[model samples]
Target: MADATPYEDSTTPSPTVLSQDITLNWKTKATVRLYRPAVIPPKKKLPLIIYLHGGDFVLYSASTVIYHNFCNDIAAAFPAIVISVEYRLAPENRLPAAYFDGLNAVLWAQNQSLGIGGQDPWLEYADFTKTYLLGSSAGANIAYHVALQLLDYDLRPVKIKGLLMNQAFFGGLTRTQSEKNLIEDAYVPLYVNDVLWSLALPTYMNRDHEYCNPISGGSYMGRVKGLPKVYIKGDYGDPLVDRSILLAQYLQSCKVPVYYRFNQGGYHGIELQNTSAAQQLYNDMTWFVNDVYQNLNSQDLSHHHASY
Candidate 1:
């Protein structure tokens, strides 16, 4: 998979877009690619978006050309600072490895926001207080796990206001109607999904594991209650659509604020392949981010008044 190069660097140079790669942890070989708008006034801070690229947990990295292009485009479109995390993959690093790396990346971002970590020009304008965790496919799964981990600790000035899962990769022991119907697709086939789960999940664990299937219950049910507002997108033709639906229902059951969008006649990862679809998804995401920002401001104001 590493030898397979999907596309040449087709990223159009934009005066408004600027990006750089930074190492998060040397020992774990975890890295992050930071993207932000080039123009910013003095003391201006932008919402920080920590992006996890999708590759079924075993395929791609932040350096992948396609993902790099996606991150660059979104950074410019949203006009926010995007930190695309390069977590350790599976079959070599396995389950929990990527999750740990993701958490570490968030912590590293926190340190940067607090001015304790090594300097980076982009992070200087990052508003960690209004952070968002976003991912697609397996990356979205990683983002979910990382958010759960974050709940265990108190992170001041680095609040995770929302989570955006674009066609999130999730499965279970039982087959859904979409999965049975859409055996083969352009992005990810049924067999490929099965293989990815095998490679990513622990040896003893099956598809029912909480890592692969959050609704399988165990720890996830308890953790789901405190999760931030979640926005989930699903493709009609994708096999994983049911998984997203189930997740939305589960979140709603837990009384967590959840927003979901399902696209018609779309396959898994269609946004990455279709320009129009990608643009629409980006627009939706921007709206979600704006809504979250307004809520954050209101919450802060309420807290301030209560403190007084």
Candidate 2:
């Protein structure tokens, strides 16, 4: 059952930024907040970043103050149009509900790209060909599932060039060393983490379910091989750090293009709370996005040469 009381901070005032909220599905109240740069170049189409906010899948919304601030910074830094998805949370909607909302967000983007959806001024300057999925913690989990869902169909005019996962939220039935040794901090306490998982995961599934633990082999392992280029950043002190390492190793074993970075002396979701760390991660993400675009161009050039 869903928690009747909503989080107090969920509706906190957001920093002054150029953003607008739109409803993707009126029935389910699924919506997304679109953020744009303070200044837009004439007739310039920038890369699109579809962001998912982290809240252990049971708390927070796209309008949450921390998430809104983070998206604003990202939009200004990367000069990219960001669409922060407001998916239905768990307990109320459950596991696959969030996943479906994510897919709907992507489909909405596709429609906007084609000019079939309702008018959105920001979409006019959105470069769908370079769209990227950006998420933090539980949001990253949603991004991963959305990427997998897209594999079954063609999303023309809207290409998912890469995935940027920061402090991804994943769990297993067995505890890792970090989980056992690390003391619960302000960001995420061990007991709270367990409770959140119990509330978010499917009623019939455990921590090892593929939705919660991507590395837990089932159908997930088979689908991982063809995923888009991925960039993962994790904190050494985070309990989920080992999960990131394991995921990186698995992607490598499957020959998937992946880049993983571990930040020492940090904790889960530190980037949002710390200014310097947030700037550095933003810089890293900017570089990664540029590199992905460069690689895509090179591939195009090679195909052109082959055709000649």
- Worst lDDT window (10 residues) for model 1? 299-308
Candidate with top TM-score is 1
Q: Lowest-scoring 10 consecutive residues by lDDT in candidate 2?
A: 299-308
Error of 1 at 52 (Å): 0.4
Q: Model 2, range 204-287, lDDT digits (tens) per residue?
A: 799899998787776767888879988888887787777777776677677778776677779998998789889878987887
TM-score of each predicted structure versus truth: 0.89, 0.88
**Candidate 2 displacement at residue 136 in angstroms:** 0.5
- C-alpha-based local distance difference test score of model 1: 0.81
lDDT of 2: 0.80
- Taking all chains together, the TM-score of candidate 2 against the true structure is 0.88
Per-residue lDDT for 6-50 in model 1, tens only? Answer: 222335453567777776655655678888776877898888999
Error of 2 at 52 (Å): 0.2
Question: Over 4 Å off in model 1, which ranges?
Answer: 1-14, 292-308
Structure candidate 2, residue pairs in collision: none
